[model samples]
Target: MTHDLPYNGSASLDALLDAAVDAIIISDDEGTIVQFNSAAERLFGYAAADIIGQNLTTLMPPPDRNQHGQYMSRYLNSGQPAIIGIGREVTGLHASGRTVPVHLSVGEIKSGGRERFVGILRDLSEQKKYEAAVITLESQLAHADRLVALGELTAGMAHEINQPLTAIAAFSDAGARLIDNDNDAARTELKNICGRISQQARRAGDVIARLRRLSQKGELSKSSHDLQRLVQSALQLFDHEVRRSNAAIATHFNHRTKLVPVDEIQIQQVLVNLIKNSLDALAESATEPAQVHVHVEEEDEHLYIIVEDNGPGVDPENEPHLFEPFFTTKDHGVGLGLSICRNIAVAHGGNLRYKRSERGGARFTLSLPLTYIG
Candidate 1:
């Protein structure tokens, strides 16, 4: 039976090996191709007839191909294995000259006192391409959200600068009238008005500078900053939006401490989104006092900022989908704010989440990495 087994056994084994999803290859003691399965041909973009007798090095790239012969020789002479019976990630050269990433497990087999190596390969090309596509889509969505935020900001910004601009023009006219009247008291009052005019001009300049910086979408510049200061800065960004929606703001920060290490502008962007969401939620509420509360706390190795509103909370069914891109409950919302906020939080090695507030409203919390303090 042992002598008769060789004829049919080989055919059955080859058929079974061909059925596997992963590629299988067997090489002779001299590292020449001995057997190639159907999956191997499909994965390498080559026909079995084309590679059956070729050197195994044909599957490797430049440096790896050069080293493979020496590695095999050393293993054969010393009886010490380098990759046998172990799985490893390596690059493979496809017939199309493309390099493919693969996880390979090789085993050494002995037959008629000669050595052979069988390799099982699992390709990563499809998985890698899917991951790249997801990342690209996310980036495009974030960009769209920023454009929507800019549109809303433009309206608020007009209001923010108009008040100061009007004050400057009125002050300049009064100063000119006082100069013509030639009265000392009126002239002094006019000088004071001129000073106020200059102050307002400077405030408008500051607002413009902030807007310009936010519009550029600069690369993240990280540093240690005061969390309290960050919150105050972000409030300025949303000043007009909150006022137009009639949302009242309350803040709760631990006065004793305020410090963290992070990208200041990015964190401020997160705050602006959270505050805007709060204002939107409050606008939809029928409550007498539309309130938004911002709280910041520092706990071991992390800083937490919570923005809560006394507004209509999210639907229970929509809770899981809140952070998803292009998901929104508002008519004018582009649905990118929360998603961008979460992306910024994750990029900062932190997290963002939404929950029900104690006051029966929506609460968005941003947790950030803190500098390690001894």
Candidate 2:
């Protein structure tokens, strides 16, 4: 049923359809292809002569092709549409047997006692490929970031484990002396020594676990996690080192219990790196009553994980390179702590940046997008 439909006063309707960017296809009430534009010809690799008068489902994949007729029948019978105004993402079959991702929108037209449905399809193959490439790039950057952090972590772990090993050695000597003495208090001393050894061993193991988390390689595992809990755990892991450095710590929570969806392990590494950098700054500075403060607050629909130090702030000259890869002021890392943290932050659709603390020290802020919780 070809109509002499007019477009403006000059352009023919066929010319307009052929000029359109999106593929346009018209089907009758019975779901037979009535018309196919040049764009549709290019999109599905089908000629208008071959496509018209055929079942419209020929362009759809298996299940959609099977169910489309029934859906159209239901729509016609009920005068209701399953998907009309809004578009849907579906797989379309090309004439060359290739499956393409497309966004499809359908519009209904009632003219001269006839009902016609028009479909506009947008090819999403390029978009899908681009997204895949971005994901792969992010994964690679994360792996490299972790590896750089691991280099610095190695020194920290060695220095960290030495204390626990020394304690373990002392406890072993104490247990042996208690056994040799064989006094009534010997039993209590032996139990205490055994407990001390277990504690020390666990301390060393904890360092290894934290380091492994950052250094492990794989696809990102993103999920909803409690920010407060992560902060607490990171601080707890550094408890002994903080105490050894005689640094006082304080924390403020929002009480709103902000939960964020992210790669928790990677984020935890970020927090640890920030804290470690702060500790390094504190150890090198002459600030009295060294203090490290962590605050978790929400502002502007963002969750901010902030680590601030009262130690000397970042050097004015090195500010720009602070987040640069392989830029380190220390003997251990390639300065990957800040770089990786920023990478993780960006990948999570958030940000990690450094600011000047009121105490004239470096403040690292990790801001994450807040999710809507129902």
Candidate 3:
């Protein structure tokens, strides 16, 4: 079983290394570069003759450049592995003084009792650029979706603000009338009217504030928020629609773990979309005494916000295309809501799923992990 290849000579090995598509570098135990293949020379902007015999650390960026020797020493002395066989993405120092993204794998070689190490590197700059571009596109899409949703809710938002404004106007008129009486009883009544006006003004301000927050276009910012409160806020946006459609809304919240880390605006957008969809479905079905229930529960280190309606559910054939972009069941729908919602959920290290409800209706569950990694 001791068969040796005819291409074992230095010249043949050099030719094989040069022919490889990925850059290959071989260094002695002391971290001195001994063999710099042509691919490596092209990747690092250094000629093989210039890089050979130099310290391997010369090719690394600072931080890594300063610590690579220590890493090698630690592995050689302790026989422990950090990234010897395990490959990972890292930054490479190019001769042009620019940092390049690369995936690197290292292996050890022992020949005639001397230890050497071989490193293989693949450029990851294009992959990173593509990923960043994708993130930008998703952000833009989510923002556009939010604006569309807000546009649809314009009527409800106007109704919400109008109620408080109407009350404030009535209270203000009564206060003006009492100003002419000047009696003790009239003065007391005037104070009560003034308080009512202030309260109504605050109520109107709150409605406007909620609308402003949801309609805002910006980057995804994560923070701790009460899930139940977020759901309630979203429901407020549909008050007029729910009343007009004669729909009954119910909610159950688990207060024990209601707080979660998420981009509040985006999460609220998801809630708004789901609740609106449920309301729309109920409206279309004309189900007797339409009912929509929202429940928040915590199980197995995950938080779930479930929205279900007692209306016509999705057809079996349409289930598979629910999350596809530009697919819709509505006559005037652009169909990006579910797709964007699912992307937001996944971006937060969670998920969105649909299922048949116990009451024979459509049910959507948004699950978010309690421990957020982002």
The TM-score of candidate 2 is 0.47
Count of backbone collisions within predicted model 1? 0
Computed on alpha carbons, the lDDT of every model, listed in order, comes to: 0.80, 0.82, 0.84
Cα distance off (Å), candidate 3, residue 331: 35
Per-residue CA lDDT of model 2 for 1-374, tens digit only, reads: 23233122234777888999999998888888877889999999999888887888899889999999899989889978788997898899999998899999999988777788999999998997776567557646876776766667777878999999999999998887789876778898898889989999999999877664553345567888888888898786665567458788889997474667878888888888888788888998989889999998888778898899999898889988888866988874556667768877877778898889998798989988886322
User: What's the candidate order when arranged by decreasing lDDT?
Assistant: 3, 2, 1
- List where candidate 2 sits over 4 angstroms from the true fold: 1-11, 145-155, 170-374
Q: Which candidate number maximizes TM-score?
A: 2
Model 1 steric clash pairs: none
Scored by lDDT, model 3 comes in at 0.84
Scored by Cα lDDT, where does model 2 land?
A: 0.82
- Assess the local accuracy of residue 146 in candidate 1 as a C-alpha lDDT between 0 and 100: 67
Q: Please report how far candidate 2 places residue 150 from its true position, in Å.
A: 5.7
Task: Show how many residue pairs clash in every candidate, following the order shown.
Answer: 0, 0, 0
- For candidate 3, write residues 61-157 as lDDT tens digits: 9899999989999999999989999999889999999988899999999886778899999988888777656755765687677657756777788
